[model samples]
Target chain A: MDFFQTIIALLESTIRLSVPLIFAALAGLYTERAGVFDIGLEGKMLGAAFAAGAVAAVTGSVFIGLLAAILISVLLSLVHGYASITQRGSQIVSGVAINFIVFGSTVILGEAWFRQGGRTPALSGDARFQTWDLPFADAVKDVPFIGPIYANLLSGHFLLTYLAFALVPISWWVLYRTRFGLRLRAVGENPGAVDTAGISVIWLRYRAVICCGILCGFAGAYLSLAMNAGFVKGMTAGKGYIALAALIFAKWRPVNIMLACLLFGFLDALAIRLQGNPLPLIGQVPVQLMQALPYILTVILLAGFIGKAIPPKAGGIPYVKER
Target chain B: MSNPYAKLPNWAEYGLIPLVNLVVAFLVAGLVVLLVGENPLNAAYHMVNGAFGRGEYIGFTLYYATTFIFTGLSVAVAFHAGLFNIGSEGQAYIGGIGVALACLWLDRTMPWFVVFPLAIIGSAAFGAMWAFLPGWLQAKRGSHIVITTIMFNFIASSLMVYLLTRVMKPLGSMATQTRTFEAGGQLPKLDWLLSIFGLNIGNAPFNVSFLLALLAAFGVWVLIWRTRFGYELRTMGHSPSAARYAGISETRITIIVMMISGGLAGMMALNPIMGEQFRMQLDFVQGAGFVGIAVALMGRSHPAGIIPAAILFGMLYQGGAEIAFEMPAISRDMIVIIQGLVILFAGALENMFRPAISRAFASFGQRSAAVQTKGA
Candidate 1:
C-alpha cells in the first residue's frame, strides 16, 4: 500500500513541476509560429514574478497580483517587440538585451527597496493559491493500480497543472482552427506573403508575442506562488531556457510541447528522487549522474542523431516594412 | 540611398570607420560611468591607470585579458562562419568537468608534460562535443543555433551544480567544488620572461596562457583569411546561396565551424585550470562567452581586430570591479550596462556612421572628414 502511494505522489509531483514548463513552452510556440523568436521569455517571466510578488505582498490579493504580473510582462513584451519589430535589430541581440535588463533590474530593485538581499518577503499562507482536490478523488482511494495513481497522483495537483494540460488542446485549436492562427503561421513562414495577402505582419507578430508574454507571466507566478511560495534571486535560474528547448523539441506543436514538458519534468523529478529512492537493483547512482540526466538527454535529442526537426523559416528575421 | 562611398576620401572609408567604432564603444562605456554617477573623466583615467599604468595593475589586467582572448576568438570564429554559438558557457562547464575529472583521475600516474597536454585536449574535446549538438541540429534539422546554444548553457549549469555537489566533491571540504589538481597540471607563468625583459612583473599572475591565446587568435585569423576552408566560410556567411551555387556544403562547413568555435572557447579553461583556480570551478565561464559576444561585435567579428577589443574589455571589467572600492554606490555590474549599450550601438552602427557619409551631406552638413571640417 505504501509503495503504491509513493508512485501516486511521484506522478502528482511530476505534474506540479511540469506546469510552468508547459505554459512557457506553449507561450514560446505562439511567438515562433508568428516568426518572432521569443528568447525574452525568461526576462518577461522574471519581470512578472517580481511584479506579481511585490503587488501581492503589498495588497494581499492573489488576483490583483496575477493581473499585475500579466500587465508588467506585457509591457516587457512591447519593449521586446518594439526593439525587434520597429528598429530592425537582430532578434537575438534584442532578446538578450531584454534578458540582461530584467535580470539586473530585478536584482537592483529588490536590493534597493526591501534590502532583503534580492528576495521578496514571503507571501502569507492566506494570500497564496490553494491546491484543491478534484471531484471523486476520495471515492476511488481503494481501486487497484490505476485508481491509486489517479486519486493520489493526479487528484490533488495544483489548479495550474490541469490548466496547463487543457491549454495544449486549446492552443492546438487556436493554432489550427482559427483565422488568426492561419495568419500567425503565414507570418512565421514568410511575412512577405502575409503582407501581400493584406494582413499586417507587425501587428500579428505583436499580438502573438504579447499572448506569449501573458502566459509566461502566469508561468512565473506559478514558480513563486504555486511551487515555492516565494521568490529568490535567480530563482527562475535557466528553467526558462530549458522550456525553450522543449519548445523546439515539440516543433512548435501544442500537444507535443505538453509531452515534452512532462518528459523533462520526469527527468527533473527523478533527479530529485534519486537522492532518497535510488534504484531497485542497481543501487544508488551518484547524484551527479542523476542531475546530469536532463543535460545528457537534451544533448542527445538535439544532436539530430535521433531524428530531424525544422524551425519556422522566417524565425528571427525581423520584418522591416520599408523593404 | 546615394553612394557615400563614391565621394569619401579613401582614408575615411578604411581608417576613420574602424577608428570611429572604437571611439563610439568607449563613449558608450563613458556614458555608463556617467549614469552610475561616477566622474566619467576620473573613471576613464582610473581605468587607464589600473590597466596599463602600473606593473601590478597591468599584471591584473593581463589575467583578465587572457580569458577574454580565448572566448573572443571563439565568438570571432563562429561569426566568420555565420553561426552564433552561444553555448560557450555550457562548453566551459563541460570542459571544466573534463579538466577536473582528468586531473583527479590521472594526477598520480602521469608526468607533468603528458598530463598537462592530456588535460587541455580532453577539455577541448568535451567542449567540442557540447558544440557538436547545435552544429548538427543546424546542419541536419534546421534548428536555430542561438536558441539551442542558450538551452545547452542552462543544462550545463544544472548538471555542473549536481556534479560538484556529488561525484566530483573535493576530498576534505563540504563546498560544491572539485578537489584541487596536482601541481603538474598547473599553468606555468612567464613572469621569468617579464623579468628577463626587466619589466616590473611583480605579483602579476601572467602565465603562458597569454601566448597560447595569441597563437589561437592567429590560428583563427589564418583559418578565416588564409585557407581554402576559411574562404568558403566567409563566402557562406556573406551569402549562403552563392556558396551553395559554388559547390560548398553548407552543413559540413557549419558543423566544422561550430565545433572549432566551441573548442577554442573551451581552451579558456586552461587559464583557470593552470592558473590560480588550478582546477575546475563552478560559474567558470562567468559570462565570458556572453562578453565575448560584445567583444566580437566591437571587433566587427574580425579575428585580428579582436585582440585589442579583448584587451579593452579586460581593462574595463577589471576597472569596474575596483569602482566599488573607490565609490560605494556603484557596483561591478556597471560593466554589464556598458556592454549592453556598446552591443546595442555597434549592432546598429549603420544609423550613426552611414548617414554621416551621404553625398547629400557633401554640400553643407559636412565635407571631407579629415580636411573640410577643419577648414570650415
Candidate 2:
C-alpha cells in the first residue's frame, strides 16, 4: 500500500510537471501543422513569462497578467509571421533571432523593474494562481485506492493543469472535425493545392500562428504564476525545446503529444525523485544522466530507432504565389 | 524585371548592405540604451574606448575575437554545404574533454610543442566524431540536421556535467572541474609577439590561439573558394538536384562538411582551456557557437567578411563588460539585446530595406539611360 501511494504521488508530480509542456507542444502543433516550423516557442514562452510575472506583480491580478502575456506572445508571433510569411525569410533564422531577442530583453527589463536578480518579486493571494482542492477531497481521503487517486492525484491542482488537459481534446476536435482544421492540414501538406483551391494560404497560416501564440502564452503564464510564484532567470530551462521534441516524438498528433509530454514529465519527476537513491545493480544513478534522458530519447526517436517520424511536408518552406 | 541591387558590384552587395544593416541595428540598440536610462552616445563612446583604448584592452578584445572567428568559420563552412550545424556548442564541449584528456596524459612528460599539436588533433578528432552521428543521420536517414543538432546540445551538456563531477573531478576536490593543466600543456601568450614590436599588453589572456584563428581563416578561404571541393559544396548548396544530376554524392558532402565544421568549432577549445582557464570547466563555450550564426550571417559567409564581423562582436562583448562595470544603469544583459538586434537586422530582416533601396537605384539608372538617349 505504501509503494502504491508512492507511485501515485510520483504520477501526480508528473502531471504537475507536464502541464506547461502540454501547452507548449500543442502550440507547436498548431504552427507546424500550418507549415511554419517554430523553434521560437522557447522565446515566446520566455517573453510571455516575463510579461505575466511583471504585470501580475504590479496589478496583483493574475487575469490581467494572463491577458498581457497573450498579447505580447501574439505580437511576437506577428513579427515572426511578417518575417517568414511576408518577407520570405528563413523560418529557422527568424525563430533563432526571436529566441535571442526574448532571452536578452526579459532579463534587462526584469532587472530594471524589480531591482532584484533578474527575477520578479514573489506574489501571493490573488496575484498567483493557488492550488484548489476539489469538492469532497478531504471526505474521501481515507478511502481505498480509488479515493486516494481522486483526492491526491486528481484534486488540488492549479486551474491551468485542468485547462491544459482539457485543451488536448478541444485541440483534437478542432484539428479533425472543423473546416479550419481541414484547411490547416491541407495547407501544411501542400500550400499550392490550397492556393489553387482559392483559400488564402497566408491568412490561414497567420491564424494558426496566432493560435500558437495564445497557447504559448498559457504555457508561460502557467510557469510564472502557477508552477512558480515568480519569474526566475532562465526559468524555462529548455522546456520549450523539450516540448518541441515531444511534438516530433508524437508525430504531430494532439493525443500523442499529451502522452509524449507525460512520458517526458515522468522522466523529469523520476530524475528529481531518484537523486541520491541507490538502485539494486546500478548503485546511484547520476542526476545529470537522468536529466538528459529525455533529450537522448528524442535523438534516438528522430534517428528512427522506433519508427520514422515525418514532419509536415511543407514545413520550413515559405509559400510564394505565382507572379 | 532584373533585380536592381543584383546589378551592383559584389563588394557593394556584400559590404555595403551588411554595413547599413549594422548601422541600423546600432541605432535601434541606442534607443534601447536610452530606455534603460543611459546616454546612448556616452555608452557608444565607452564601448569603443573600452575595446581599443589601451594595449591590454585591445588584447582582451582580440582574445574574445579569436573564439568567435573559430566558431564563425565553423558555421560558414556548413552554410556553404547547405547544413545548419547548431551542434557546435556541444562539439566544443566534447572537444574540451579531448583537450583535458590530452593534457592529463601528456602534460607531465611531453614537451609543450608536441603536446600542443597532439591536443589540437585530439580536440578536432573528438569534435568531428561527435558530429558524425548527426551527419550520418541527415545523410542516410533523412533526419533534419537542425533538430538533431539541437538535441545533441542538451545531451552534450548533460554528458559534460556527468564527466566533470562524477568521472574527472580529482580526489579531495569538491568543484565540478578538472585539475589545472601543467605548464607544458599550456599555450604561450601573445605578449611576447606584441613586445617584439615594442608593445606591452599588460597580462591579457590573448594567446597563440589568435594566430591559429587567422591561419584557419586563410585555410577556410582557400578550401571554400579556390578548390574543386569548394565548387562541389557550393553546387550542392545552390541546387541539390543539379548536383545529384551531375553525379555528386550528397551523403559524402554532408558528412564531410559537418566534420570540417565540427573540427573548426572544436579548435575554439584551445582559446579557453589552453590560453585562459587551463582547466576543463562547465559552460566554457558560453554561447559562442550560437553567436557564430549571427557572425556568419553578417559576414556573408566569406573569410574576409567574417574576420571583421567576429571582431565587431568581440568588441561588443569586451566593451559590454566594461560598461556593466562603469555604468550601473546598463547591465551586461543589455549587450545581449544589442547583439540580438544586430542579428535580427542582418539575418532575418536582412532584405527589409532592399526593395526600397533597389527601387531608388532603379529610377536613378533609368534617368541616366534617358539622359544618354537625349545626348544621342
The lDDT per prediction is 0.76, 0.90
Residue B121 deviation, candidate 1, in Å? Answer: 4.4
The CAPRI quality class of candidate 2 comes to medium
B325-374 per-residue lDDT for model 2 (tens digits): 78876788876787777778888888888887777778889999999999
Query: What lDDT tens digits, residue by residue, belong to model 2 across residues A235-284?
Result: 89999999999999999999999999999999999888898898679888
Tens digits of per-residue lDDT for model 1, B311-353: 8788977777666556654556657656665665555342356
> In candidate 2, what fraction of native interface contacts survive?
0.60
What is the alpha-carbon lDDT for the whole of candidate 1?
A: 0.76
Per-candidate DockQ values are 0.24, 0.64
- Per-model TM-score, in order, reads 0.85, 0.98
Which fraction of the native contacts appears in each prediction? 0.17, 0.60
TM-score of chain A, every prediction, order shown: 0.94, 0.98
